[model samples]
Target: MQKVVIVEDFCIACYNCEVACVATHSRSEEPIKAYKRENLRGRSNALVEVNGPIAFSAMCRHCKHPWCLDTCISGAIQRLDNGIVYLDEERCVGCWGCVLGCPYGVAHPNLKGEEKHAFKCDLCIDRLEAGLKPACVEACPNKALIYDETMEETEGAYNR
Candidate 1:
C-alpha cells in the first residue's frame, strides 16, 4: 500500500503541524498542557520542526528491506504483514542501530525521554486498525500531511 508523503514545496513552515501533532497525541487533548507534560515527564511519540519551511514529518517506512530490523542485533524490531514495523521493548538492547540506520532521522534513542530504547512512528497501528487516519495527519491544519493506503494519483510529480 502506497502511503502519505509530504509536499514540502507547499509547506509554510508554520508550527501548526507541530502543535497539531501534540494535540493529536496528547492525553489531555490540549497543546500547552501536552508540551508541559512532555517536557516535565519527558514522554514523546515524535518530533516536528518548521523553521526550514522543511519541517520533517515522518513515520516508519516499513521497508521491504528494513534497516531497523536488520541492524537490530537484538532482534527487537519486527516488520508485520500490514506494512507496519514495531519494537519488542523487552528484547531491545538500546543499541541505537535503528536510530542510526533510519535515513529520515526520525527514530531516536529515547522516545519517552525516560527509556533508552529507540522508537519511531509505528504509523499509529491502532488508528489504522480502526480505519482512522493517523492523529498527526488528521490534526494538521495546513493539510501538509496526509495518510492513504491507496495512492490513486501521481499529480505531484508534474507540479514541481
Candidate 2:
C-alpha cells in the first residue's frame, strides 16, 4: 500500500501541506476562493504537530485492520484492496463512530452544514487515479513527505 512517510529531520513546520490539503479537498478547488467562501469550508486531513524543534504531519495510516471500518455500524467505511480506507458520506449517519474508533484521531466530523458526516484522508484517490501525488506530499517544499516507495528505498533514504 502506498503511504505517506514523514522525514522529520527535513520538516520546517511551514504547514504548507495542511494548506494544500484543504485546497485540494475544498469544493471550490482553489485556496483563495475556498477561504473567501463561507459556505465552502475545508479542513486539512493532515495535521501538523510541533514538539520543541521537531515537527511532523499526522493523518490516517490506512491500517491493515482499520478500527473505523470495523466499528462503523452504518457500513460507511470500507478498506479497498490497495489499503485505502474510504468513507462514504452519503451512507454516513454522523454518529462519530469512526472519529472515536480511529487510533490516530485523524477521523473528524464534517461541520460544513446542517447535515453532518465523517471526514478524513482518502489518500487523494482521485489525484492518484490521475497519476498525481497527494496534495500534501506534492506541496512539501522541504520534501518532508515521501510516498509510493518500496521498503528498501525508504530505508535507504533515511540512511542517507
Which candidate leads in lDDT?
2
Deviation (Å) of 76 in candidate 2: 0.9
The 10 consecutive residues of candidate 2 with the worst lDDT sum are 151-160
Candidate 1 segments whose C-alpha is farther than 4 A from its true place? 19-33, 38-46, 49-53, 152-160
* Alpha-carbon RMSD, each predicted model: 3.6, 2.7
lDDT of 2 by residue, 49-108 (tens): 899998888888877789999889998999988789998888999999899989888998
What are the per-residue Cα lDDT tens digits for candidate 1 across 1-160? 5355565555555556556555655678688888886552333344555564466555555666787787898888998887678877678889999888888666667655556787666666667778888776776667666667775446443143
Per-prediction TM-score to the true structure, in the order listed: 0.75, 0.87
Query: Clash number for model 1?
Result: 0
Please give the CA lDDT of all the candidate structures. Answer: 0.65, 0.83
Q: Which stretches of candidate 2 lie over 4 Å from their true place?
A: 38-42, 149-160
